[model samples]
Target chain A: MKTLIVVSHPEFQDSITQAFLKTSQAGLDDVTWHCLDEIYGSDPIDIQAERELLNGADRIIFQFPLYWYSAPASLKIWEDDVLSRAYTYASEEGHLKDKELGIVTSVGYPKSAFAAGASQSFSISQIMIPYEALAKQAGMKFMKPLVIAQFGYSTDEEKSQLLVDYQMYLTAKYPFSFNERETWMIQQLKKLASGNMKNHQQELDLIIQELETGQDDLNDLKEQINLIRNKEED
Target chain B: MKTLIVVSHPEFQDSITQAFLKTSQAGLDDVTWHCLDEIYGSDPIDIQAERELLNGADRIIFQFPLYWYSAPASLKIWEDDVLSRAYTYASEEGHLKDKELGIVTSVGYPKSAFAAGASQSFSISQIMIPYEALAKQAGMKFMKPLVIAQFGYSTDEEKSQLLVDYQMYLTAKYPFSFNERETWMIQQLKKLASGNMKNHQQELDLIIQELETGQDDLNDLKEQINLIRNKEED
Candidate 1:
C-alpha cells in the first residue's frame, strides 16, 4: 500500500519529535513523507496536485503536533482548500472511498493526562472526532491513532520502541495485528541482514529463526484448541 | 460586560449568515465584532494587539462557519499565533481566567443530522469538545454553543428567533436561565421603546406593563411556594 504522510507543524524544523519521526520512516519504499509547510510555505496550495497525491495513496496519514487539541493551521488550510465537497463527499464523487485515514499526533502533555477525570479531561479519541467524522464522510476507514506523548522526556529505550512503532504505523498492514507486525519485523530483519549490516547477519538469522519457531508453536496451539472444540461438537 | 467576538470565516464577505449576525448585533454598545480575516487578511496576526483585545473582554466568542467539523483555518491560525503559553495557562498567568468562552457556529447540515444514527453522526457538543477543553485549561466558563444549522433553509420567523438567540449568546448573563432571558428581553424592549421606536411608545408601554405584571405574579407564586416549604419544614 502507498502510504502518504501529510505533516503539518508551525515549527517543523525545530521540532525534535518531528525530526525523529522523519528519521524513523526514512527508508520506507512505499511511504511518501510530504510536509505541508516545507512544500508550500505562504503560497496557495495547489489543490489539483494535492488531490492527485491523495488519489494515489491507499492510506493517508495526518501527522502533526497537537495544537489547541487539533492539527495545526497549515493542515487545516490544506483541508479547507484541497478537499473540495464535490470530491470528498461520499454520497457525491467519493474520490477517497475505501481508502484509509490515520492520525499520528504528538502531544505536549503526559499520556495519562488524557482521560475523563484527568488534567486534559478528554480522551484522544474524543479530541479526534473531527478527523474521524471526515473519514466517515469520505467513506474511508479511520485507523486507530498513534499518540506520542512527552517525546522530549522519553528514555533512549522508549525512543527505540517509538521508532519501531512509528515504522509500523506508516507501513504495516491495516489493523496492525500481532501476526502482521511479527511478519513485518522479520522482513525488516532480513533486509538488514542482506544489506550493509552483513556483520550482524548471523545474530539476526538466529533471532529470526527463534521468532519463526515461536510462531509455529503458537499456530500449533491454536490448531489443537480448534481440534478439541470440533471434537466436542461432534 | 464587554464581549469580544473573534470572527473567523474565509469567505466572510459573501456569507448571508454572517451578515445577518452582524446586523443583529449592530446596536449593541458593549459588543466588539472583530473579524480576524478582515483585519489580518493574509498578513501575520498581531499577537500583542490580539492578546490585549482578549485581556480586555469579559466574554470572548469564537464565531465562525464550521469547516471540516471545526473552525476555519483563519481562527486556528489566530489561536496558534496569539495565544502563547505564558499568557493563556490557567495554572500560570491565567490571563483568561474567570472570563467566558462562547461559540457561535453555523453548520451546513440539518440540526437533527448531528446526533447518533444521523447523517452527521456527532452532536455539536461532541464536535465542540476542543474549544470546551481550551476553556477548561484557561479557567474560563464554557458557554453552551449557539449552533445555527442550515441557516439558508430557515424561515423568516426562525431567522427572527435566531437574531434574538444570537444576541442573547453574545450579551446575556451567564447560565442563561429563563428568568435571566425574560429580564434581558424586557430590558431590550425598554431600550427600543425609549429610542428610535418611540412612535410606538404607547403600544410598547402596554406590552411592557403586561410583562411586568407577569413577572410580579411569578414572583408572588415563588414567594408562596417558599412559605409553604418553610411551613412544611416547621
Candidate 2:
C-alpha cells in the first residue's frame, strides 16, 4: 500500500527526533514523505496537487513533533485549503474513502506525565481523539498512531530503539487499543497459543480460548462464552 | 481570571466570526485578544514576548480556524518557538503550571463527518489530543474546545449568531471537567438537548440545563446520562 508521510516540523534541520524519523523512512518503496513547511515556504499551498496525493495514497501518516500538543500549521492550512466539504462530501467528488490514516508522532515529554497527578492531565488516546474524528469525516480508516514520547530527553540508544519499534508498528495490522475492557481482553488472549489450543485454565480461559482458536463447537465468540459457562456449571 | 485569547486567522480583518468575537471580547475587564497573524506578518515570531504573554495569563485560549485538523502556522510557530522544553518545562525558571489552555476553532466541515461512518477519520478531539497532552506537561489544564463547523458555508444571520455564541463560549466560566470524557459527555449532553448543537445552540440556559446546573457532578456524569435517559424515556 502506498503511504504518504507528511512531516510537519517547522525547522526539520534542528529537530532531532522528527528529522531522524523522516530519514529512517527513506528508501521505503511505497512511502512518500512530504515536508509541509518547506513546501509552503514561499507561495500559496498547491491544493489540487495535495488532493491528488491523498487521493492516491493508501495510508496518510502525519509525521511530526508534538508542538504545544497539536500539529504544526501546515497541516491545518492543508486541511482547510485542500480537504473541502464541498468536494469531499456534498458534490460528486468524494475522492477520499476507505483510505487509511494515522499519525507517527515524536513528542519530547516523558510517558509518566500523561496521567492524573502527572504533569499532563490526560492519556495519549484521549488527546488523539480529534484526529480520529477527522478521519471518520474523510471516510478513511483510523490506524493506530505510532508515538515516540520524550524524544528530546530520551537517550540516543533509546531513541534509536523506538525508531525501530515505530517502523514495525507502522506495518502492523492494528497497533492501538483503547478502553479498559478491550485492553484486558487483549492482554488475556495474547497468552493462548496459535500453535495448539488446549487446556484452558478456567471457564473464562475456555471461552476466551474457544473464541480465539475456534474450538469447542462454538462458531462465534458469544456462543463460545455460553458454552464455557454451561461447561462450568456442569 | 485573566484570559489571553490568541486569535490566529491569516487575515483577521476579513473574518466575520473571529472579528465579531474579538470585538465583543475587547471591552471585557480581564480579556486580552492577541491577533497572532497580525503580530508576525513580515518577520519571524517574537518568542520572548509570546512567552511573557503566556506567563501573564491564568488561561490561554488558542483561537483559530480548524485548518486541516489543527490551527494555523502562526500558532505552530508561536507554540514551537515559545514553548520550548528548555524554558517552559525543564528550566530552572518557572513552568506553565496551574494554567488553563483551550481551543476556539472554526472549520468548513459539518460536524457529522467527524463520526465513525463519515469521511473524516478521527474526531476533533483525537487531532487535538497532543495539545491537551502539551497543556498537561506544561502543568496546564486543557479545557474542552469551542468548535464552529461549516464556517464559511453558514448564512450571514447564522454567522452572526455563531459569533455571539462563540463569544459566550470563550468567556464562559465553565467548571473544571477537563478530559475528553467529560468534554464528550458535556458535548453529548448538549447533543441530547438539540439536534443543531454542532452548528448552533449557543445560549446558556440550554447548555446549563443539560449540565444540571453544577460542575462536580459532571465528574461522574452518570447523573447526566440518567437525566437524559429519563428524558428520552419520557
TM-score of each: 0.96, 0.62
Instruction: Give lDDT tens digits, candidate 2, residues B1-234.
Output: 788898888878898767667776765567888998887784778888888888888888998877656676677767776877766663334457887887888876788766555566556776677677667567677788878887768888987677555554555555533543345446545644556444455564467565554546654697778889999999
**Lowest-lDDT window of 10 residues in candidate 2 chain B?**
B176-185
Candidate 1 chain A: worst-modelled 10 consecutive residues by lDDT: A210-219
Model 1 misplacement above 4 A? A227-234, B223-234
Highest DockQ among the candidates is held by which one? Answer: 1
lDDT score at residue A162, model 1, on the 0-100 scale: 99
The sequence of per-residue lDDT tens digits that candidate 1 reaches over residues B206-230 is 9888888888888899999999999
User: Weakest 10 consecutive residues, lDDT, candidate 1 chain B?
Assistant: B80-89
Expressed as tens digits, the lDDT of each residue in A1-234 for candidate 1 is 899999998789999999999999999889999999999999999999999999999999999999889999999999999998999989999999999999999999999999988889899999999999999999999999999999999999999999999999888887888888888898888888888898898999999998888888888998999999999999
Relative to the true structure, how large is the alpha-carbon lDDT of every model? 0.93, 0.69
List candidate 2 segments past 4 Å from native: A14-24, A37-43, A87-92, A110-113, A149-234, B90-92, B99-102, B106-131, B141-234
Cα lDDT for residue B182, candidate 2: 44
* Top candidate by TM-score: 1
- lDDT at A14, model 1: 98
